[model samples]
Target: MNTQEQTQLNMLKKALMQSQYATVIAQCDDVLASLTSPEAMREARYCKAVAYRLSGQPDLALHDLQQLVTDFPDYGRAYQEQGYCYQRQGEDQNATYAFYQATRFNPALLAAWQQLEQAYQRDNQIRALQLAQQQISFLTSLPKPLLGATDLLHDGQLFKAEQVCRQYLQANKHDAEAMMLLAEIGMQLKVYSDAEFLLESCVTLYPDNDRAAAAYQALLSKLGKFPQAVKQARRRLQNQPHNMTIQAGLAHALVGVGALNEAIELYRTLLADQPARPALWVALGHALKAAGDTVGAIEAYQQAARQAPDFGDAYWSLANTKTYRFDDAMIESMVVAQHGSTVKLEDNIHLCFALGKALEDNKQADQAFSYYQRGNALKRKTLRFDISRTEAALEAQQQACQAPMFAQPGGCHAPDPIFIVGLPRAGSTLLEQILASHSMVDGTMELHDILGIANSLSHQGNAYPFNLARLSDAQCQALGQQYIEQTRAYRNGAPFFIDKMPNNFIHIGLIKRILPKARIIDARRDPVACCFSGYKQLFGEGQEFSYSLRDIGRYYIAYEKLMNHWHRVLPGQILTVQHEAVIDDLTGQVKRLLAFCELPFEQACVDFHVTRRVIKTPSSEQVRQPIYRSGMTQWQQFEAHLGPLFDVLGQRTNR
Candidate 1:
């Protein structure tokens, strides 16, 4: 209340308003040091704590809040601030308790109610819905909407959600929730400019709303304003020191801006508390790996596995990490455990495929083959297109590829590049790893560049058949140019790059015409084994192809027929790397593979895993180890369970 104290307080407030959090923190600290009156000191401590929290120093903020509550239990704001700090630290239980205390002291504190609801939602407690409903009811009885138009935005109905929010905002033009909701709706619609405007409005109107702050930070991140995002995240964390979500968001922004060390520190702090969160563990593991702390990364992954035993990602990472090692018993055990535990046939197939890789890594060729076979068997049952239909498509594609190119002249672009195409989980990734290890070859896993080009060329009015042969010579040339340009992004100036889009099997004809200089490598496994493997693996997104068994099998059969046709027409243009053949003659096959790619043999190529390169594939772990023979015959163990698959394979015995 004195002039000097008032001056210091005003400076702190001004610093916060300008988002100069560090200055605010310093000002608060100076004022606190000079305060003598108990009431004034309490106020100064609160301000300092707020500043600390905002500066990404939540532990210090929590300490101040805790001391304030201990000294004055009736302080509602202190309880609310303490709850926020606890939430940021991911101490949900403590955060809930603190929010309850805040509500008990001041029932009308809507921020406390909102924080409590978020805590419940984060924990996935059913009571969260009831609490949200209660908050909504309280607002409904008010003459004016205290929040904004966007407060009415619900899940599942985007258009209706927007309309409700807009109507609410029309009635109360100054509603922060409505502005925030409009921003959210804009973000959803990919209208970044609109969203940014609304978020800015919300921040200006409701400076105290941490949700607005969080949203503003997210918008800044979207706009590539990482420094601003980091600043905002730090400030928001001060308001709620314990919140893991805020910490994670801040860490992500830091990582985006290449501040790996800082991000690592933040992740490490988060992990120290909730060491069991698989996502946090995975993120920390990735950061440590990027920092070249392989041992530390492994330890983090192991801890993640221990915490969430059924988490497939942890096991997958572990399996991949050990794929090149001579002893992959741990990988085998995890894969087998995964296979045994999951009732979904697809899950088992993926486990079997991984098991095959682990077995191969361990030099168990016969067992590896069996596992590979089992994976393929499962795959055959789920494909969408039949063998006959695929064969017909392949015939058409071959004819198209063979047709003379008169438009651009120069002998139809000269197919000089090698492509490894197949359905996913059919040893395509493994094959790419092996070939990429060669001195003259570079492997680019599953690039979308080629497919995107093919898609554009195939567009003829409304009737797009998803068939490659439907495209013309001119279209193919244009597509080929697009593919080359797109792939230029991934090219490390290597002589040869592998375009291993598994679905590129569908566009072999288009690829041949566009890059007539490209060679084609079809990575084939037994249909049953491939199909089964496809069934078992869980893709993160955009694999609508794996939703059913029969669809997968048909897709495989179609791929096989096309590959076969390409072989007959293009002849030596396409090389077949049978999964079994590769396993049977590792050295001989690799030498042959090197000859095909016109690369001089190197002993180092045989031990490819030791060569460090950025591997962006699911098999990153497997490629790190030396070659082994474990994956040769892994299907026999699950023979009883694969009757349908076996029947289909039985009919294809002639092939």
Candidate 2:
């Protein structure tokens, strides 16, 4: 925003705070007329609409807010004002949906959350009401500055949020809520250790704060500290025997620890009392699928979709199973639910993906690609991804790291981790499954420890790889040991574990600097196939680059460049495994991979589909069956929609 527009906005805020609605409306109109920037105009329109609503001109307010939201879909204040206007016009359903959009866009909006709770309660929407209550309780405990930080975080302004929270903390040293909020921002930025330290401090300072405790446990779980998180959840549950929140926490932790039977039973017990909860049903379905109970999982997912037609996760869960087929009626229902403006942004995105899958299954390639494009476009609007930053980081790694850096041999000597790294949808999961099938290798979730260590050394101006030169041998060894110790909870006494975080391909130098003995595998696939596959899939979090075809292709180009640099700097350090090579010769490729990991060959590795481990990727169901060549050609069906990817890949697009 320009200086003049900012001044006008500040004046509008003051007028609204002082209940000068006429002044707010008039000033907003004048400022909007003078502003040419879309952002400035949106801000002005927001102020005017709110003033109109407060002045009892709700219809006019709704019209203006609707236009504002259509132009800028991520504006939370506009959605909240639209909710107010809808409520004034006696349209309770529209009001509820608008309120939901408000909270979804900016979770720190306490008023939006409270209004949603009341709307849900009035309509007796049991599951929605419970979720809104939990959100309200969580937000109400945060400090005011931290609440603003949360809104900034949700708006994809990470650096600004961190700055505000850090400034608040510098003045108020003992504020637990500010620390927790900052920790959350750290997690979102992929700096896991800072998040861990902050959450640890918050829990110590405010032991009675359940929200902080829950967030701390969740961070631990994300770091693959399953045992510690489960233990903490159990202790909390024991203290508060009737607390459903603690019970739910335990159920989630149990899933993390691979105790599928216990988790399923706990979910069933919980659902017996609150069967209307769609999220619980989705959780149960996940557990059942992990336990190889496909029929039971399908029934649970169907139940969830039936109870809450607008709950996008439930429908997406069914589609993500890979084996489940959406019937015609179900597809029609999704299409109808996605058409209205009042549908939540997330729900609409989910419907787009679900519809894409349904049409793809029916061989309607053109229609399927349309839905896929819409879904990606909608999702991309909410993410803060800069391709140039990624390219610069890769360039920095090439300039700073040389072959001599590896000659020092200055990291921890433990060969406990085998990392499978590459682009998403590039067959890393399949490789992990094969290696995890070995008795000596434990398969864990995508561990964030290495990324955490690398991110701690990064600054806004200087990317990683450039930051590694400042670390001494002692510091490197300590960081390596910290990773091993923190990840011990995810192991079952195996000699080695696999951390298959795909994005770790960017941090190969750091991984080698810290854990010199760790094995690295580069999982590669056809560029077009991989990028297009990622474009069609919907990730729960992260992987923002995959939401656009051009972004995905550019990311692939950078990834290929970095991997080539790694090979040049540290030759013979990484084992390159082609996805097609594995499919064509499973026996030989399995032996080659085992040789790279320095492990004895076993039948279990070859018969990986029957190994009975928990798989947590989009390819979960695909890996549960025998290896097939179908996915290699799946992208060809929509080749017309993938010209940008081919353009980026150039000669690399040859299949």
Candidate 3:
């Protein structure tokens, strides 16, 4: 709501509390008349409900309260009002239940708690009365500012919550709860490292606090620290062996750590106990797919679809496998689900992307692009991608890592990591697969270590690349060793492992300072094809620029400039592998890639598609097949709607 609307709301609330029912009703009507937003309309309706209740229209008040609670389940005041309506109608049991729900959502609702205590006593429920007493006690024990902050956080007023939390923390330096709340705000703001640090401190200072440990584990999982998350999950499970939630967390962590068998088994056991849970089936499908059991994965995905017909993730999972062909029934189901009101925005987005892929595979280019654009547009609403910020960061990388730094650098001489760095959908995974097929290189997932390190070094005033110049040689060496040690879990005993994190291209200078001897492969692709591919595809995370054609185009330009700088400053230290070149000359490119990494040529490199491993990228299915030229020009089908992309690519491509 706007400032004027909020002022009007406060006035209406005060009038209602003072028993000025007629005034509140009239003011609510006026506010509703001026309000266009649904949230504002709902708040006005709530005020109107209070006026109606005070005027002895209990039934009308109950109707409004029920509708409000239906629309927003977490609206504690609506539940409290619902209880009042029930109490006025002599429905003691219903009043008690509604009051319980009110306190469940917001424990600071002292009036609700008192009403609940009275209702429980009248009903002679001693245990429930004690529970209500404990809740009230807990709320009273918490600082008023912390309580207000908690309420604000629950209401999604993140900035206000952060302010209150910071104020509380300033007064109480050891306040773990306040730190946790601030950490939650940081997580919501996508400042992963800051959140991580706060949660780490909370867990360390309060080791026995399950809430802090659980929050830390979740943050680890979010940051893709699967091994660390699994460690935390294991510790939590040890203390609460029968906790199904913790067991599920452990299974998810297992999946992240590549323990596919263990994850699949845990999921199967969970599914057997909770057969109706579609998420478990989805998890099972992912594990099966990652383990290369395509048939099993298909069955698991189909089971998930059967369990929840509108679960778009299941359908999207099938489509994302890239080998699954959607039947007519499946296509109809996805389209219906995408158009359904019951499906959430996230699931609807998945349905749109799935339908896009299915239609594209069926030769419906127009419909495919429509769905892709729709999905990207929906997902882009949640991201904060700044083109200028990205360009500035790239410029910092160029400026900070001049030739002098490289010349005086003392980096860890560990040539054990083969870095495949570039934009997503740029054949980085393909290059990794080819190199990983060689005997010397172990194939790892897109490692988050470099990104995590960069995030750790980054701050509000100084982002990464710019901050790299401040690191001494000792710090650089430590960072390199940290990367190697952190990545040990993802490797076998192979002398070299492929870290196919595509965005790592932006951190090549940092990589040079740390692991200077590490092999860096610039996985280059045609700008039009690469950008359009990213536009059509839905990555799980990062690559936010891909949601818009213009953003991706500009990012591609910046990426090209940075890569050129790396080549100029480092000179022959990095190798460039063009996607089209690889497709055209697979054998020659394979030899070149192996030679660059100081490896002898092997037939396995040429037959990389046949390499048996867990492929995580969207190109997993494609990399399992021989090279084809069709995908190189697939962007041409959607050229008419790509004016923004072409405008950015002007003078660089023959548009």
Tens-place lDDT per residue, model 3, 1-655, is 6888777778888888899999987777777888866556777888899899989998999988877765665677788999999999999888888887777666668789999888888888999999988877876777889888877765546778889999889889968888888898888767788899999999999989998999999888877789999999999888898887888888888877888889889888888888898878887888887777888988998999999889988988898888899999999999888887446656877898999999988989899989998888878754546788989889988988888778767768799999999889899888988998988889989888888888888773576677676778898889999999999999978999999988899899888889989999999999999999999888777788999989999999999999999999999999999999999999998889888999999999999889988876888878888888888888777777788898998934434
Q: When superposed on Cα atoms, how far off is each prediction in RMSD?
A: 19.7, 3.9, 6.3
Residue 594, candidate 2: how far off, in angstroms?
2.2
Q: Total clashing residue pairs per candidate?
A: 85, 0, 0
C-alpha lDDT (0 to 100) for residue 68 of candidate 3: 79
Q: List the residue pairs that clash in candidate 3.
A: none
Query: What clash pairs does model 2 have?
Result: none
- Please provide TM-scores, in order, for all candidate models, with all chains considered together: 0.52, 0.88, 0.80
* C-alpha positional error of residue 400 in candidate 2 after TM-score superposition, expressed in Å: 2.7
Candidate 2 TM-score, C-alpha based? 0.88
lDDT of each: 0.65, 0.86, 0.85
8-112: candidate 1 lDDT, tens digit per residue: 667777777777878767677667888765556667777778877777888999988877765655566677888878877988888887887776555546678
Error of 1 at 603 (Å): 2.6
Query: Model 3: what TM-score?
Result: 0.80
lDDT of 3: 0.85
